[model samples]
Target: MELLRSLTIGQYVPRASPVHRLDPRTKVLATTALLVVVFLARDFAGLGLFALFLGACLLLAQIPLGFVLRGLRPIWFLLVLTLLLQVFFGGTSEGTVLWRLGPFAATREGLVQGLFVTARLVLLVVATSLLTFTTSPVELADGMERLLAPFRRVGVPAHELAMMMTIALRFIPTLVEETEKIMKAQMARGADLDTGGLVRRARALVPILVPLFVSAFRRADELALAMEARCYRGGEGRTRMKQLRYRRSDALAAAVVLAASFAVLLPGRFRW
Candidate 1:
């Protein structure tokens, strides 16, 4: 649980901007469309446009740039690794040679491929960050439940899945704070967590994990009891305290996303 807390990405800063006011479903669909656009993009120009689109969305969402980049920090190493691998191990076909080293030749095709792939991944992550930052977990889960209502009849427990997701998202920040507190408490007691070798450090985590697990189970037990005491059940005719409704803003946002999708797909001098 402690390990999981530091990795959570569900913390949203609430705002009253147009993006924040838009329905969660609209933001979700727009992000999904942008993801598809990133993957379908074939050249640098298309990738640039996709990045611009994401930037505009982020600006509209009013999420802090520092916060978004901070969230991306944990995966920066992986992104670098992937880019390096692509640059060297990519390109199964011949193209203009850019560099010739001992046993490897870097070609234009490989360079373009690697750069485009990295840009695509960056755009995807940024777009998703925008979605999560703009939409609160409860709103997201509620929107998702309503969006997935049609699947409820095909043996799909849509409401249950959404409720589970809501709980998990809602608890991420709380758990992260708890983990930090526990680590600090242990450190104050002279626990040497930072100066140990790999194996030794792994063994040292036992104390942290045990308490984390105990606290997590205790919280879950209390939550279950509270739910039962309130006569809570599954989504069987359950009414929401704040029901989600799609307004003109949602339609406008959807229209903008569809237009952007078409713009990305349209053919012209930039066509690849």
Candidate 2:
């Protein structure tokens, strides 16, 4: 299915760029900070500032804009639906009426609200996709484990949690590929997956899901056995092939991110 091709969240692109060279922990924390700014933003100016920073990060990563945006193709319908809802049924009813359709009338306030919400959603996706595109799953896991290690004083199992999260992220592309293969195999067997009503199409997908689930479980079992064979214990006493260390670049990057964050927050906070 063409749907699988648009997914870029789990796929990594290797490049000799500043973003890729930074410490993984720094990137992870920066991503978290940007997401916080995205959620805290209340107006277009704040969101626009965040968008500008995200665009710069995209450029530094050496990833194609087209490839990063391809992840949005699958969610176009969702974005449209969200926009339409906010335009038609916003929080307040008092504003200049733009258009009317039966019981629902689009208002100026509703339009602004719709655009703001949609922008946030778009920025959120691009920010996260940038992280995965730059950092491999292994690096992500290592960073997360180290970041969470301080919480190990409690009953938390940082290593296991990171391992699980990494494995799940790593399996996304594999499962997508498996789903495509199953879909094609069914298509060749005279399966009519297309050209059907809504209900009929829902029924058509059932065959694909069953086989896909079975395949996922089979793969999981094999992986578990393989790990056991290698005596893969938890992260305790395990050393990395390449230990992560924060370099001078990481500090400069952090300083830039901090300044950019304050710049974004202040623009909409107090008149500048």
Candidate 3:
């Protein structure tokens, strides 16, 4: 339950701030651009610049820093494992060896590489989290549909895809809660989930997974029925009560992200 609650990626927080007020399309485009630049970044300077940028966004959104950081908790194990793996297994043999842990030699280059890769991943998650934090799932769907509409000429189901993505994000918390309940129920029935070898642990998951799948399918069917009852059709004739438009601020937001990406990424290419 604690692990599931730590997932903040799909959660939304309402705020009356510039970041939240911007057109969702602008936010979507800017986030995509930021992610691209983050992946293209070569060194710490670029990541630092992005970290600062995201921090500023967090402040503008008036979201608690603790809430954003909480998302990192669930992934702590993965991060530590990645750090350990890179420390002992990554980097070339010609690099400087820092020390040895058992039979594994930790290299200076590997440590540096591990830290860099980890920071990159942190930035990526924070960026996406910021987007979902400021923009509601409905707005995200509309923005995605609009952005993907151009591809409709080539037979893309923009509305359908956007709707699916939005529904998935909105249901994350619900599914997580259901999973927790199922686990607890099984635990009460004397199911040994924690104390087990690797294979035993894998086998234990079967009970949890079976019920979860059934619950998920049941929910999906109910949702489908509900939508059908409402005569749901998001096609050519569909109209929205709230229309999305691009304003000067939207243009400025995109320009700012592009400018920052160049400012950081271009200079980032020439590194130590």
Candidate maximizing TM-score: 2
Question: Positional deviation of 202 in candidate 2, in angstroms?
Answer: 1.9
Report every candidate's CA lDDT: 0.79, 0.89, 0.89
lDDT of 1 by residue, 111-185 (tens): 767877777777778878788888899989988898899998898898999999999997777777877888888
TM-score of 3: 0.90
Candidate 2 has an lDDT of 0.89
Off by over 4 Å in 3: 101-103, 270-272
Ranking of models by lDDT: 2, 3, 1
TM-score of each: 0.90, 0.95, 0.90
Q: Write the residue-wise lDDT of candidate 3 on 1-272 in tens digits.
A: 47777788768899999889899999999999999989999989888988988898899899888999897777788888888888888878888999987878999899999999899888888899999999999999999999999999999999899989988987888889999999999999999988879999999999899999999999999999999899996766899899998889888888888888887798766664
**Which 10 residues in a row give candidate 3 its minimum summed lDDT?**
263-272
Query: Over the stretch 15-58, how does candidate 2's per-residue lDDT look in tens digits?
Result: 99999998999999999998888888877888888888888998
In model 1, state the lDDT of residue 79.
Answer: 83
Pairs that collide, model 2:
none
